[model samples]
Target: MAPLLICDNRAEVERERFVPGTPEFRRASLALFIASFLTFANIYITQPLLPLLVDEFDITPAVSSLTVSLTIFALGFALLIFGPVSDAVGRRPVMFWTMALAVLPALLAPLVSSINQLLLIRIAQGLLLAGLPSVAMAYLGEEFSPRALGLAVGLYISGNSIGGMSGRVISGMVAEAYSWRASFLVMGIIGLVGVILFYLLLPPSAHFKPAPAGLRKGLQDIGEHLRNGSLLKAYSIAFVIMFSFVGIFNYITFRLSGPPYNLSPAAVGWLFLTYSAGTISSTVSGRFIDLAGNRVAVILGVLIALGGVLITLLPALWAIVLGLLFFCFGFFAVHAAASAWANRQARRARASAMGLYLLFYYVGGSFGSTGLGFLWHARGWPGVTAGIIFMLALGLLLGLTLRDKD
Candidate 1:
């Protein structure tokens, strides 16, 4: 065999590929936007409910963190599988159907009688949820032109930011007003709505190619992509950003709920609204990175993130909220850039590369959420803040090394 054709047949297909401004393009973008929203919202719904879990289960912070961490951990492993599987089968089927299946676990969450049962249910949902992110990244690379990739990726991420905000905000308010169970039910219903819309709206993949079926070939393809230095560096950025991001959000609730501030759950949930900055930053950052270069864009994003972390050290509520705003923007900015860059680099094994990226992304998240809880428990808010800033500093260093200047 002549070194197996990768990159698929998309170049020939690209003559008629979806650009940024066609009816088909608009529909694809909208569908992906909705898909991104539903995936992220479902994944993070348990975050704001952590305090309630702590109280109800009488577990330690690290233990309570498991609800989110274990799900992410499961998601991490599942990404490695789902992405490759989609490569062999098809993107459309994998993207929409797995999402539909995930709603079952979400609906079951509220009905669980014990923490263990709830955790098990969440873990199952996490596994099912993995098909969306990796497959979606691959779908973007296949369907859109390089010119539109950055902006399209940004739009997708903006949906992610908003979905995350909605989940935190809605869950917190519902949990505060009624109960955690009520919040889970609400998220399940919302997820179902998004799923239906995604299935109906997303235009079929016009440029997709089916990879060889089986786990062995998928692993081989994944291994080939992993050896690229630039891709590996991009993967590091994914891990660091997610580690710092998820860990911070995981524990910030603990600080606010128990502080001299003594904020209510609803009020704490309002803090996630700061994520709106991400909505703007991700879109602008993508367009900017497309025009400028990845090096400057990545560095600028990391610096902004560092500034955000430093601001949280201040002792005022207004200052904390502002810091979170900066943090949200910075993370989403880098995420849009890095995710686009990663997809672009794969040129060949796009799905495999995306799967690997998310693998590190969520695995790092799993570790950070639980690992940082020790800092939160031992040394309090100041300690947790320092740890995150340290990770952000590392991410900044890695960001400086990216060679993809497109």
Candidate 2:
């Protein structure tokens, strides 16, 4: 009798599931995408401002790199706390408050009188901003149907790609026109608007089940996940890919704006529009991954990105632009596939798995950018490309080893 009742319950659950291509699914997917875009844009708005920061603070390239690196590091650390808290409390409440508070740092950044104060606020901003990324994956994992998950994840990542691009473009343009301080003010205003929209649009989760265990169980789950070889490889891929991506962009603005190019900030801002290629690629890859296997998509993405790195070695301006476009496209393709794959791979403590993935991801960005500054100084773009090529080669090797049997 008990077995029959369990079967009946499972059948009922399947009956109530939402199908793909429905209006409700589309609405939910779009809202999640917007949320992702705003969250990531707020996080990365400072990328193009590194050079401006150096000029304003009279700091060296390495020191100026901290303006972005510190934020990523804080974001990584904050996830450790935020992910577990979300599991206890629920996703929406934590996300709402944390995103709201994230705006405060952006508002405060322009008013800071010292570089130390600005860096402090940026760190705080990264910490607060982590709430969205840490929880959004959990939300998708619990809410979207398996058939719809790929589309939903792709849309969210599309938001990330668009946000990252626009953030850099807008900040660079605004700073060029006025002051670097103006850039933060704009980001704060946009973030406030996004917060309002997110609250209004995102529906409550239908499938969230609170973990039965306390903090000890959560900690043990994290330990178990870290010990899993496949999961560890995924985390490593994220770290290396993000490290190479951020490291290059962290200093590229400075490099382009000085010396041979002497490009204005507005022109530099336009370069970020190349991220549209990433946006498109991410969405396309999302559908492809759903059709093909993750391993194939990931391997192809690595190759494409590697090709982009090679292209950047050419001294011509056109070659650089073409390289950036391919770089952005390949990055999004890999990221969208890997992010969804992480959720699929983790049977328990999915949020924690994603949190750890992001932790390594951002830490890689922080250390990669700062550490590679010396390489940039010593050997220029050639040195940077050489390092990225090595990292991508390793990523491809790992991608080949990934088993998608599940």
Summarize candidate 2's per-residue lDDT along 120-179 as a digit string, tens digits. 998998899889888888888787778777877888889988988898889888989998
Tens-place lDDT per residue, model 1, 303-357, is 9988988898888989988998999899998888888888888867688899998
Cα misplacement distance, residue 53 of candidate 1 (Å): 0.7
* TM-scores of all predicted structures: 0.95, 0.96
Superposed Cα deviation of residue 244, candidate 1 (Å): 0.4
lDDT of 1: 0.86
Clashing pairs in 1: none
Write down the TM-score for model 2.
0.96
Give the top-scoring candidate (lDDT). 1
**lDDT for each candidate structure:** 0.86, 0.84
